[model samples]
Target: MTSCFNEMYLQGAVRPPYARLEGWTRAMPAELRQMKQAEAEALFRRIGITFAVYGEGGDPDRLIPFDMFPRVFSHAEWTRLERGIKQRAQALNAFLVDVYGRGEIVRAGRIPARLVYQNAAYEKSVVGFVPPKGVYSHIVGVDLVRTGPDEFFVLEDNCRTPSGVSYMLENREIMMRMFPDLFRENRILPIDSYSERLRRTLASVAPAKCDREPTVVILTPGHFNSAYYEHSFLADLMGVELVEGQDLFVEGEYVYMRTTEGPRRVDVIYRRLDDAYLDPLCFRPDSMLGVAGLMDVYRSGGVSICSAPGAGVADDKAVYTYVPEMIRFYLGEEPILNNVPTWQCGRDDECRYVLEHLAELVVKEVHGSGGYGMLVGPKSSAAEVEMFRARIKANPGNYIAQPTLALSTTPTFVADGIAPRHVDLRPYCLVGESIDLVPGGLTRVALTDGSLVVNSSQGGGVKDTWVLAE
Candidate 1:
């Protein structure tokens, strides 16, 4: 088995980024650590910062575990990551506009035509219509995993409604509240401005019809949805209305929000729901979670959507393999961050190779999220492998396989004491008239010993990410 890279320690000495944290961890007593952990959990519960797992019988709302140990990065490291993230965001938005308009990348033989037009997430309704600012995906959540000090690979992209930024902000808030001296000691960058930046990004894409300061509202799929807390949290932070489909209605050309004062015009909608649930008239007619004729209003330039209607195609796992090519084709630049080596099961040779090496590779559904519908090969039993093999053979195009990467680890507070656990980073990059992201991102840690998965639904925990100032 390959050894994982430890982010905090190297050769019995602490890494530069984590030098300050070493003494902090060593000085904390076990009883005090336990008390702080309990206090953190209570705060999370009180704040209602919880998520629900679908098809589960347990409590509908569960608090994601919070690790007190923070993951740190130096200024130089973060500068490189920021550039890569912004570059990827630009390429993704450019790809969305290209694929929906002239299909230039497809016509130029840079990417497969079938992959763009035939995918399930592709919407034909907005083919010729260009969104405001030509930005389809306003918030790009790029999941990154590190294999070594200088090797960071984008695991996947979430161009649609990506959840977890609320956790990123809340984690830092809790940490600052608990350890006041730590904040004074370490010049960690501030991420509190994320909400304001997000609001500005959304407003920057308001439709041309709006001549005044645009009113932006977050469209949520009701409280039953898993990310309901995030929807309300962001609304409160940004001072915008968090409304469900029922709270909105479509007029002749524009959409309006129902308020006690009157029917107020909504200019920009930061929708947190999927495409199929955005407009009942255009998609999924039975969907009560979307407004009727909302698509028409959006297409007619009455209101703008944060991530335009057909943005999902750019984030498909199959399409992810072509992102580097997209950077070259669209931006005429090399990809700053690389993609993990992938094998598309839709191809005959790749499918055969994946079937033969099912136990050595990690396989995931092309559209899967929240850590579901995946097989961690090394951790699975023979029966599990056979089951996945049969599923893959039945539908080859639905799967993609990649080598099980040795994900880097950070110091995490465990049952016995501090230990190294596998971790991953998901930085939410905002795009509008420009592209930018906060210094740090949400760092998820696998709480179980030697586990590679770092999803909250999969028993993983989150840690406050620190990008120290220069």
Candidate 2:
């Protein structure tokens, strides 16, 4: 358990609640638990809560593990995080505009041009084009966690295809059945209207010349990646068609999709695929997960795409350190949220500092996620640390280090009963003409005894976040 908490802090997960009530000690009746599980399964069938996952032999269906307990947050804490997230999203939008339009920040040396041009994520296709609403990244998910009673730090910014909102809604429904008495008594915040916010944001960025009721499609990568549930869920809730890469095409300056009737004009696309897989003509030429000539149509102002193509460059971990500065530089306001102390390996002084403190710090590869390319101090072997040291020296620009944090813990339900598990919150944001962030978001938990990795791909699970009624 000590090692788990130690790793969690090292990895930058939000500090969890300290108190834990274990087992049947605080659990509801067994019959209640079973009833809740059954009720949740029924609700899943009725509401069609799904994410497409490819099973062996190429079959695909939505699959997400739903939990019955809803993590509760006070309004006071939530409001602060919301303000910070909106500010961050706005600053990122501003940064994207500068990068693609003027290259002002890059030329001014505020950010490295090498980082911009060399990153696999950056694109030259949209350099001169502007979005419909002058906005990119219509949806952003900011990962956060409570490290203490009031200490919540910003983790990652998921501007490109951030998912797991469906889990938030479905988890809450399960909780309602599993712990009805506790839920009723506790002042949990409502998170049912997220899809409404999403729909509004998507509509807000429709093409200026689009018809009164613009046709929006959710572009997907065809059921192999995780978080496919969120893709279909948002599409169903928004009442839009969910399309794969092959279903779309570009004709003239307008983008269109293949329907039963024929090619239909598409004004806005809520794309769930990454940049490289979005348009083969614009990005990786060999990618079959993209439509040819799609970028040209978007560039010509015939269509709008969420999070635009090059938005990922701004969400990089190294780029994150400059966010507060970006907020101040662009918005002329102080940052509402704080970032954990960071060490950029590219800087000589920073690299020296991190190397000296390797025994007490956590290091991460700038581009990797799901807890890969991580080294935890106080837990790493000498051999492991040396290997990481060499890796950092080899690609200093791609590595960063920070002091391990003691992420707070919350009481989580497990097979052994209730125990303290590290947890983090990822609140969703919709940035169109304006910022529209949902009150409740997904609360991911590190399910291992004391392990701090909370990614679903890393065997982590989730809980529904309940923002208490104000």
Candidate 3:
């Protein structure tokens, strides 16, 4: 039997980082644990911290399952991970800048020109104009999974609007409220400053034309869109207004928010909508989600978009294979964090290999997210695999495949008892005048016994992550 690496234990002994949790888990009775879990759920409901799962039939706003057991890491472990994350974020922004400006990477043959020019995420609207501070991706979320005690790999990059940061904050708050003693016993780093730091990062990237204090706002697609809770929650935390498309208007080169007082000039927009929906005049004509003339204002330096539309080029699944080369070309340093070896199905030989070994690999669409449009070869039945094989054959350019990794497991609080479950981390990296991230991030676990997917939409739950203070 192939045993998955357990994060909390080694040779049946508790690891140093998880030593403090040993007694807490033992002293708590099952009844008390159940009661606390119920209390956590009630608190979530009262606070209105719920996510919308569209097409789920019943009540759409459902609470994401929260686990009491925290995933712990030592100070040294986090320091290393932090450095790698920062390096990756810097490289991503550099690549975005180069692709939109010089096209040097393409000329040098480091990345294919078609990969950028033909990519759905690439935009030619703001080609000549650069963002303030030249930072294209203001906030970067890097998905990571571990396979051993000292091994971690970057699963994917989220350069656009990455969600679930609200969960990170709420999880810590709930944990502290429920078990203040556990926090007191352990020396863990504080993540309370993330909102303030995020605000500062945004303000630092205000457009050059701004003379007064920059006004920041969170642009949402409204309550109907998923991740609405996060949009409203972040706005409240950052002391900014949460506005829909109808709430804002653009005239003569500047964007403004309609207010009871008057038209308020807005300088920075942390938009949560997609690129095509950003400007009906520029993209999807029927979209009521984005401001008209917003892209033109952004190009003219009248307003600064948080991610600067079209930053998604860095995170495209096909573009991911060239990140290591990007690090070398842009940063002049080898990658500290490794990407899981990927096989693009667009290639004839690779596609042939994938079809032959369909049962041992995981295949995913280039544009897939939230665990949808994917196949877990080992878990799928014959008919499902055959269906996927046909789908791949029809459009080979739309898919990528990777080996089935034995993701490390963490002890989770389950119905029967504590059991090991696969988990992954998504640490949000903020880029602007400076690059930073809160010490801990959202730790998602596969709620099912042996499953590997950790997306909330796929029945996964979240756990608070702890980076022990030195």
| lDDT per residue as tens, model 1, 1-470 | 23788998777788899988878988999999999999999999999999787666598798889999999999999999999999999999999999999999999999999999999999999999889999999999999999888899999999998899999999999999999899998999999999999999999999999999999999999888889999999999999999999999998889999999999999999999899999989999999999899999999899998789999999999999999999999899999999999999999999999999999899999999888999999999999999999999999999999999999999899999988899999999999988879999999999999888999888899999999999
lDDT at 359, model 2: 82
- Candidate 2: Cα lDDT at 87: 95
| Each prediction's number of clashing residue pairs | 0, 15, 0
Which prediction has more favorable lDDT, 1 or 3?
1
Candidate 1 versus the native: TM-score? 0.99
lDDT of 2 by residue, 1-470 (tens): 45333211235553332112123234576666666657776777677665443233232443445555556666777788888999999998888888888887777777778777777667777787678767877888888866666677887787787877788877876667656665556666666787777778888888867877778899988766666557877788888999998888888888889999999999889998888877777788999988888887777778888879888888888887888878887899998988888999989999999999998988988887767788887778999999998999998989988877777666665665556788888888889878887778888888887766787655677877777667
The 10 consecutive residues of candidate 2 with the worst lDDT sum are 15-24
Estimate, for each residue in 223-246, the C-alpha lDDT of model 3 and write its tens digit. Answer: 888899899999999999999999
How many residue pairs in model 3 have overlapping backbones? Answer: 0
For lDDT, the strongest prediction is 1
lDDT of 3 at 155: 94
Q: Kindly provide the TM-score of model 2 when superposed on the true structure, using C-alpha atoms.
A: 0.88
Off by over 4 Å in 2: 1-67, 107-109
User: How do all models score by TM-score?
Assistant: 0.99, 0.88, 0.99
Sorted by lDDT (best first), the order is: 1, 3, 2
